[model samples]
Target: MDDRPNPIDRNLLGIYLNDHLAGATLGVDRARTLADAESERDPALADAVRPIAEEIAEDRAELLKIMRRLEVPVRRYKIVAGRLAERAGRLKANGRLVSRSPLSPMLELELLRLGVEGKAAGWRTLRRLADADTRLDPGQLDNLLERAHRQLDTLEQLRLRQVSTTFQESGDRPVHQESHA
Candidate 1:
């Protein structure tokens, strides 16, 4: 048996936890600062920070997995934060558009079978469809539908932001509209 502890194992199981936590916190803090600074100087840079924050969050999760595999208990705070960070990363990956552009007839039929009807009911219906496999409770279904709606709202916000940026960049000139005589 090797009496000497593996340096890599010691580093990963010991110093790595402290360093990972510190690095995650510092990275997020620096990203926030950079975003604030760029908000005034360069909106693009501020937008860029969103992706950077997401990357740091992903890195943090990978580190957590390694810690878990080593039989080390990660702090509860870190675990919770990692979950939230993973969610944020997922939302970023999903992009800005929720795309409510007409469900397929088959999907619509499925929704009707699930007892959901009419517009604005698509999300709830879709949740029902998903719950078929996931076996989510009623409350869970409600929460999932709420999240879907929130995602749609995020898309709307992004669209509005893009429009505002375009207007500002175009010197506030209204787009040319043709009139039919």
Candidate 2:
């Protein structure tokens, strides 16, 4: 509505020229002035701004790629924690007597709280319990804790598998489907 290019618009064009010219051809000040003048005279002249915009967009894509690469391990950690919390909640509710494996309501609640807090050690303890073959005594809450931990580990593994597949697909195709058969 102002019919004038703002600092942000000038900055965007400046960034584009900087990238397209490899920072050698266009002076930032000159590009900014040009963008400002063009914007004031005719907003339609903004079409002349595309090359710079494209370059800036390419740079942004590269930065995002780097960010996601760094986030992979952190994402895995969150998924593991989330899974542990979910299993703990299930145990606390109706899963106590339903599971053949040991799972204590009290311990499950505690582990759930720990998982929500992002504690990896809590999930590890549950995993160890789940691996053991002996059936836990119904009276012992520790067994429930162990089973919950193990389930959490399994859930994390499953999440990783799904994520890996998604990464492999890379948005070129759909990753999930409803099975009618």
CA lDDT, every model vs. true structure: 0.42, 0.34
Question: Clash number for model 2?
Answer: 7
**Model 2: residue 87 alpha-carbon error in angstroms:** 18
Clashing pairs in 1: none
Q: Residues 21-107, candidate 1, lDDT per residue (tens digit)? A: 444554444445445544544466468555544554554455455446545565656645644653453333222366211121122
Error of 2 at 141 (Å): 1.3
Runs of candidate 1 exceeding 4 Å displacement: 1-12, 75-181
Q: What's each prediction's TM-score?
A: 0.34, 0.22
Name the lDDT of candidate 1: 0.42
Model 2 lDDT, full chain set: 0.34
Q: How many pairs in model 1 have backbone atoms within 3 A of each other, for residues 3 or more apart or on separate chains, i.e. clashes?
A: 0
Best by TM-score: 1
